[model samples]
Target: MDQIKLTMKELKAFIILWSTQSISTLGSSMTNFALIILSYQRYESALVTAMLSVCTYVPYVIMSIFAGAISDRWNKKYIMLASDSFAAFCTVFVWILLRNDRLEIWHLYALNALNGLMNTIQQPAADVTTSLLIPEKHYQKASGMRSFSNSLVNIVTPMIASTLLALTNIQTVILLDLITFVIAFLALLFFIKIPEIQKEKTTQETVLQSAKNGLKYMKQNRGILDLILFLAAINFTASMYNAALPAMILSKETGGEVALGVINMVTGISMLVGSIMVSLSPTPMSRVKVILNTLLLSMSTENFFLAFGNTLPIWCVGAVLGWIGIPIMNANMDVLFRSYIPLPMQGRIYSARNTLQFFTIPIGYFLGGVLVDRVFEPFMAIQPAQGVFVMFFGTGKGSGAAFLFFVLGVLGVVTCLVFRKDKNIRQLEQ
Candidate 1:
């Protein structure tokens, strides 16, 4: 059998999309990274950062169904281009407000909510569009390119945000974010031409009936549901880490931005390396396997990594391992799902998936806040070492909270692993 590869033509089309997506993501990440730093610097509380984290996911929980419906009815390419432009304008306006030193935490919340709404529209559209642009044989390479672009954006922009925050202030970072999105918008508008993906006919079905049909299909295909649930658990678990990682590093006591930046850079580098490895060693293993293995290592290592803070080498090694493993699990799943689901209803299915799958992230954030600020702090008062405020690793009594997340992943992985014998798991790479 001849191996399928992406032609230069298709590669170019995908890259145009990928590059634009990367630029937009880079900008959003900068704001995201900056917002946490800003909140921590000013508020000096982990609670605020956790709120910001929760706000980021709240929109995903809210508009996921509507986002899916729009993608199903509309042209995704135009949606991508328009949403980027709209989001850029929102960023620009937010940047301007911040520039005058009128920045309020509420401003961050409101703008992020708007940004999340845009993302609710944009991300699913882009997710489905990958299959529209590239041939099946080329998925691994195409996926690598996307992963490469994501890692590279982090490599470039995250540190830039870090450096800018240190050297100047929030205003400049906001401006750069505004500019990057504009550049991304231009690339999508002028360079890419994605043909519309038509939805399958379900002429007689009611709305609930259509949703039921998709749900029934997924129910019968237990492996896909298993796959989705496993990742959902992992994502909910990881949300705690993501919500707190930067704060944990800064901590005024453990280390600071430099430490956070180092960890971030390591994570980005790990993702970069993982993308390359996946393309080289594409496999038929259930993506659940890949997710479980990486996240298991990540969750387990995270439980104990702070204990080794004196050993910079060990912490660095752990960071890279977690970073690489998690993204591989993620990238592979996208490929697998696309292969299994038909192109037409991908929007609606993914919409429902997004809505259901991410329902817990905000809960994770809110729970993290309550644990860190409310529970952990009180526990420390009761017993000093039991609730020790170790500023070095940013673990409060909330350390237990973090551990709980890791356990969630571990338990979820165990439940999903039993499905290895399921036929759907065996057929993804075909």
Candidate 2:
């Protein structure tokens, strides 16, 4: 009876945390969507747009290694609260700048970097808190809930921001974000209770040493290391596609922000369906196989359609198919990490994993931007009237990005196939 009661209490706490955090995430997503549209409108350069992501990720990748160790040592709740407060302040600052007409591309870049730094601290703390609050058996369900909220946010944020931009301005979208943040902040401060983790005090360890220990742990776990490396490769390719996507759609003669929003909404619905499926289904016998197979399916079909298809309907079809597998892949990956790593070490290990898996993203973003702006766009612009590239990708502004997507699709599939046969990765199933 006691164990059952404890389980119920923990589950309730997780639900509270999840709900509040999801609300906060929705706000953040709205601000991000609005900003992306704003940036693209002002500068009209893929590199400039991609730089925003680069700035955010550079700081995050740098800070995450140390932040994870700190999260393990500090009060997770306080860390989260502090991080959220700072992030809200950044949003407010952006609103102020816009109101004063002083906002510039560089300002957004700097603010995104600050937000990224805060997220490094907040993410590990939040991850640890969830691990502490939820039972091990419920990890997959919890992951699904997280994915559902994210997909819902993805669906709504684009619609909301685009509508608000049409009706009012970017300021209104930012204001709505602020309102949502306040609600989430108050709920987290007043309602959620995170259980304390008791740590064994055998010897004192420096932050550097703690961070290194995470690396050492991964070094020892060959399977986990291999998995992270494989993800790094995947992230690289995905980031390039993502960085180019906005420019691709906007540059098309028939495409615009509303078209992009519709595609995003369709993609989100597919992801929502996938999340629901994962939430209701039993744990798979081999998560490794599921991850690889889904990656194969998503990468091949989505990119193929997107690269070749010229119409919005075709783009929507690709978007939906591409996104459905993401939630399932993410849920299984979360379960794998939660199951394999010890609760106490999860913060550091997760941090380490983040560093390894995301390090390629900034590079990919930068290269994608440069390629689209300098290389591919110019090359496509000068292409002769008839060829395989022109026939498949269509000529003009968006064609370069289309060609890049095709390349990424081929590379993604090859990467998955090569990694699928790795002995270390297969061993994770055991």
Q: Give candidate 1's error at residue 354 in angstroms.
A: 0.9
Query: In candidate 2, which residue pairs clash?
Result: none
TM-score of each prediction:
0.87, 0.97
Question: After best superposition, candidate 1 residue 170: deviation in angstroms?
Answer: 1.3
lDDT of 2 by residue, 358-404 (tens): 98998999989998899888888888879778998998889998888
Clashing pairs in 1: 254-392
Put down candidate 1 lDDT per residue, 77-142, tens digits, no spaces: 888887777777777777777767787888777777777778787877888888888888777777
Candidate 1 total steric clashes:
1
> By summed lDDT, which 10 consecutive residues of candidate 1 come out lowest?
386-395
Each candidate's lDDT (Cα)?
A: 0.69, 0.88
